[model samples]
Target: MMRVKNFAHSTFATTNHQTMADAQALLQKADKKAASGGGGGFSRFFGGGTTNYEDAAELYIQAANAFKLQRMSKEAGQSFEKAAAMQLKTDEKDDAPNTLVEAYKVYRKTDPEDAARVMESAIQMYTAKGNFRRAATNKSDLAGLYELELSDIPKALEAYDVAGEWFSGDQAEALANKAWLKVGELAALQEDYARAIARFEDVARSSVSNNLTRYSVKEYFFKAGLCHIASGDLVATKRAFDTYLNLDPGFMSTREFELLQDIVTAIESADQELFTEKVFGYDQLSKLDKWKTTLLLKIKNGIEDEPDLT
Candidate 1:
């Protein structure tokens, strides 16, 4: 809690609104003094009775939080940005980047556009400082905002690709794989199976080469095979499985591999009903929800073009 300053034996406003008003007044006075390049009274009231950019930044942050208590997100975000700028100006390098991220989060709660702008600012700051890891992380967040908040798939994919590049440059292979996985998902959402499979294949290979989680490699290959099958490329599906076994030879005996083999056999026999029945009867496959069943049906639809009662 901020203690009310006693001036001339008059207690400063103790109410939240009054306190906020006083803080803003101080902020404005400081701004005026800052504009004229003259240290002002606001500086004297800050911690240690010394007015400086760093102290002004803290004051702005306090005012911003007071505004936030009243549900004023935009003002709060603006105040945080000011704090970040002042932190940078004071050569407080370590805290500057994350302060901007804090502002971006506040903006994201009420204004996605402003959130993206703030993130871009943070990215630029991080990049200029050669902090590629943080830049890549922020780029990934920006990509998510584009996808989920802005509903712009192309921009989201572009953002992910750029983030992946930065992560790769930073030798953060796991993070790079995550970005590429998202890119692959977006490609699949767009029904660009070839592109999706290609990205999935790339990530899967990288995961194996980097010796990341072993199970994920099989999952990636399975997803790629699904895409190949959905796109009516049985030969590609066979090759995908072959590649998977070669990479993790032990996976060849897993139920997932058996399921793949059964699926391939069903496709080769051109027996859509048999494929559906075999898939539904498999105990492990029963775990697959309806959407996946629908995708498998799409692959079955490719196997045979016919209109008849099941």
Candidate 2:
């Protein structure tokens, strides 16, 4: 950014139109390289990759700025569009759904309705590529973008359901967490708790996932416990809460600790709730186990951040 500012200052100070134009050209080249998945990374230590949209976006964005600097709005529009297309590639879907989100960033002048068309194009591209995971995820994302910015909830749900179909294994956990956490507040929203619980249980039960306290696992246990409690299935509730405690025991403040005791006192009746709920406990109903990673087989993927768009 400092370099950019310095270059701008130098370019604008020059009386020679030709020199100014040349400077602009260099900037354009850099942008083009960035859009083309070239140039240096965004953050050198954790920089650009072909799989990331930033690399592709930087290129086309540079091209757009070049056109804009030259007072070529039409040409700039074209570059922005090109950037959008490049960003929407199936492999780069993780970065953000280019068809909608990326396009909005680059082509802010475009109508929201038009953006919907672009999103549709992205969905089609995903589907055509035969990457069901991306297709479903992007479709759901587009639906969300549409609903939020365009007041189109029905369309949004449709997109979410489309994504739901592909939400199996890792995909399933991802989608269910999204459904549970983000849309959980929506009264009209309906989550297939049975299916989602199964997916969460898959993660909870799997030996593959390690001791990480990720939101995914947390949501899984939390939602399972909530579902059991809602159904009055004390045993299932206890089990779910037990799993929760197993995952995160440190949340037991003194008051919460006593609550666990009260719930445990009724463990017998609670066990009976198992007949109704197929789960255990009246609480997420026990003291947390304080880092069950101690006993579990932990695989270290070493991924720290939850990722922005994922």
Candidate 3:
């Protein structure tokens, strides 16, 4: 029995563990009936034209909880398994068991190999119900996990490709999510920023009046500018910064923004000697590369987005 945990003062939160225990007990009882030799597992538990879906699902929910707590992953997976079966019989399609996700989460944590085996089961459940898209989606997430957590980049790329086929172009939020994740991942890995900048730029362009337009173009310009700086295109970098500051004249923390404004002033004035000290040589930017690149990117993201205090 789980002590009731406070949920925002509503105070009626039972742990998932309790649910799992009840479910396990139900499965055991059903198993016993099947073992008596008269009925096969499927018919005795889910068949016989005797539909008590409400009871079956309730049992499953409890089992899910128990499996989660006791870490009986296989049992928990089966619990959601049983619940999904019950739902189908009752035509309670809306009651599609969420147990698959629950089971997958647990199974992945301890036994990843088993988790892959279980994900197939989840796909089976969704496919049986004629939900092809959901099956595909779950499969994609599963593959992504393998790629990211398991370090299977090729497999991960495959998953991402399949997910792309899920018509994400029509779904702004989902597309944005994938794009954001890719860009951030590449940046952290320091993989070529050119591709990342392109991804971010796509997001910025698409956001113009729909999903992305919420943030100003100044942000996009800043991002693109940093990419230019990284690729050693000083000329383009200045152009990006120029656009960024022009969009928000009083933008940035006073000192940094002023520094940038000074750079612009110097560059425009054609002060070769003064600007030489501020900028870097591509060949010369070795050990301290990331910091210099980061400083440039930060200058763009912050200055353009921040309001002018000066």
Candidate 4:
């Protein structure tokens, strides 16, 4: 066993050393090519200088892949960035953003801040080229990085909102709604009920006119109602619920609507057990996601903590 372990370790070390060496060699070659392409006074005057930016960019990309093989993420990211810059200097402007996206992917595993910065660069390039769909996709990715890695909820919300608008402009309504849903969820998390409600309602209203998204309107209205409940405004919740029922008479038949109604009754009577029972019943049929469970718990707790006014 010890002999086998030692052999494995030796092989791993040898592979890593070779990979690093290869990356360094490629990087040096790329640097030399880039320097040669930088037309100096004499080279420019003599007209003998021909930019090797394309070759340098290819070498940089190879170096980046080699660095990745050695788990050197930061080095890989830097190499990819160099490749992107080289590509930008050449006529391959389209490929430059893709190279930067590679850098963003590399940085994402270890350095979220760097990842966000690189992704923003790619997004800007994409937008500048009128590739709004790709820009929207990257913006959604940026929003995830901000929310999950950086814990910057506000930035995440903003990014999602922008992504939704871009997707809508591109006639990608389904994708737009997906991004808007993230904005709604994040807003709700921030306790910005008005913002959350508006987003959910807007999506629900839009979805009601489309056959593909019609079924989802109930869930959106349910979420909006929950947000209203969380806001401690029962009147608004009831009014919104009435509007939802009128907008889609079918919503009244869904278990989501029933749960909303039960929750409202529970809150009105300060019946914590009824609230828990209703949620548990619905959950048994269709498991509640973490977000929904959290909101329900908040509502239940609020009912329990209500002060007597009699």
Q: Best candidate, lDDT-wise?
A: 4
Candidate order, TM-score descending: 4, 1, 3, 2
lDDT of 4: 0.91
Report the C-alpha lDDT of model 4 over 188-283, residue by residue, as the tens digit: 988898999999998999999889889889899999999999999999889999999999999999999999999999898888889989999999
| TM-score-best of 2 and 3 | 3
| Angstrom error at residue 137, model 3 | 7.7
- Give the range of the ten consecutive residues with the poorest summed lDDT in model 4: 43-52
- By TM-score, who's the top model here? 4
Candidate 3 lands at a TM-score of 0.50
Candidate with more favorable, higher lDDT: 3 or 4: 4
Model 3 worst lDDT window (10 residues): 279-288
Cα error, residue 75 of model 2, in Å, equals 9.4
Q: After superposition, how far is residue 185 of candidate 3 from its true place, in Å?
A: 3.2
RMSD of each: 6.9, 15.8, 10.7, 2.4
Question: Which of the predicted structures, 3 or 4, would earn the higher TM-score when compared with the native?
Answer: 4
Instruction: Point out where model 4 deviates above 4 Å.
Output: 1-12, 40-50
Arrange candidates by lDDT, descending: 4, 1, 3, 2
> What tens digits encode model 2's per-residue C-alpha lDDT throughout 1-310?
9999999988876745654465456446655545545324563335544543455555566656665556555455555666665555525554434434455443334455656666677667666767677666666666667667787766665565556556653456556445434333221223344544554455444422544434345444544444343344467667766665665564333334333334333333433333223212322454334222211111011111113332
Mind giving the per-residue lDDT tens digits that candidate 3 earns over 7-67? 5334323545455556658777544433332333586475533344545665666656666
